[model samples]
Target: MNKLDLKVLDKQEDFFIINGKEFNIGFTNAEKERSFNRNTEEGIKELNSLKEEFGANEVIYLKQIHSDKILNYIENGKSIKDEEADAIITKEKGIIIGVFTADCVPIILVDEEKKVAAAIHSGWRGTYESITFKTIEKMKKEFSINVKNLKAYIGPHIRKCCYEVSEELKLKFIEKKTEIKKEDLFCGRNLNLEVCILDDLKKAGIQDENINSIDLCTYCSEDVKLHSYRKSQGSYGRMFSFIILR
Candidate 1:
């Protein structure tokens, strides 16, 4: 199936080898025209199929408001239904956690040693609030996850190639992330969310070598099948990216 084509986290050692290179983390494409938004019949069916595809009972997600609010699956009694958060952290196994994204970053973090994992949705607002960094801090506090042993997978999203922002927004972002050089953060008025995310991850004490990113840009990648909100002008649907401690 096209969903298995990317093999997104195959290069990483965080996943268990359940069935021959099978991964616990996954990033899905727009194959079969699936949206996984859960607001319609097709979306509900697609989301359930994803549960089957990942061999998990359910997929936990958030009613993302682009804020830095993070949730703990266990604290919610090991199950959540549309929690108001941007990131989810879980230390349990076999229960999938995920986020929906279009032209926004979908980040999966794992502590292989401790069997803890997290799924984060980071857009421009989330980025400004240091959502990725805060998620790591929460994981550390909740699960005692060591940043050095944490592996991160940054899935495809709108990069600087097709993510030009307004001058005021750019200035606000620049004002917040003063550690990164302006030239490195921006490509001539096009804000690079990847760069911003990288800085956040690094600042959170995650080693650079443990961080991996899909080079494809959702909004501009010619050959990639991932969806893009800006490219579709918000007319289409979002792709789901998830991870589990399987």
Candidate 2:
């Protein structure tokens, strides 16, 4: 199989498209519109447009809690409520699986053979909890995918340059045995969250060549195309990462 090609779609929305699939992922500004708050109706509408554009049928997703729990999306011909989970997987084509993020990492996995896909939200909690690996393991077990055949993508989020974590959060990750080398742990002033998640992916058996971990710093992007919880403080917006097998 060829290496996966990752492309940016709707940069204004911080949206992305995987080359071989029929789904899309993007971000939204919650502070700008009251209706767009917390993956609101407006955001869903934008996502639906992408689905329709790609000729997808149904959408599936999770209400991310930054935990390791992964849900399977069963097609019911309706939008799924944001249930508490960090990851969601599905084999049903046309079911869009979405996950919301601000600074946290958004992960997508696809099995070319089985036609199964996943959308995962990984924050420090989910990273320390190893949600990414857990999700991959679950997919492999359920879909019988060879680890090498699975393709992965890590979307734009907070980087080490701006993701500041107190000593407490750092210690928590260290306790979980996540390899946060001292150099990558603190970038003069902030913790490098990208490093933590990247290391986790490698540990989970994803080859380095198969992952497209964008280096875009949401906090420092002068264009303001993507949302940054750190840059905007607590009043920031959100970006949605979704995928559907088609």
What are the Cα lDDT values of the candidates? 0.78, 0.67
- Evaluate model 1: give its TM-score: 0.89
Worst 10 residues of 1 by lDDT: 12-21
Task: List model 2 lDDT by residue over 1-246, tens digit each.
Answer: 123223443443334455565434343333333222345676667656656765677555566667888887777644456568888888887666777777888878877777878888888888777788888889888878777767777777777777778878767666665456676666555767666666766777777777765546667754445677777776635677777676
User: Candidate 1, after superposition: displacement of residue 142 in Å?
Assistant: 1.2
User: In angstroms, how far off is 166's CA in candidate 2?
Assistant: 1.2
Model 1 ranges with Cα > 4 A deviation: 1-23, 75-79
lDDT of 1 by residue, 1-246 (tens): 011223533532212111222237777766445687856688778777766766786677878889999998874484566668889988867777889898899998888888888899999999999899999998998788888888888888898888999999999988998998999889878998988888889889988788877777887776556788888878558787888666
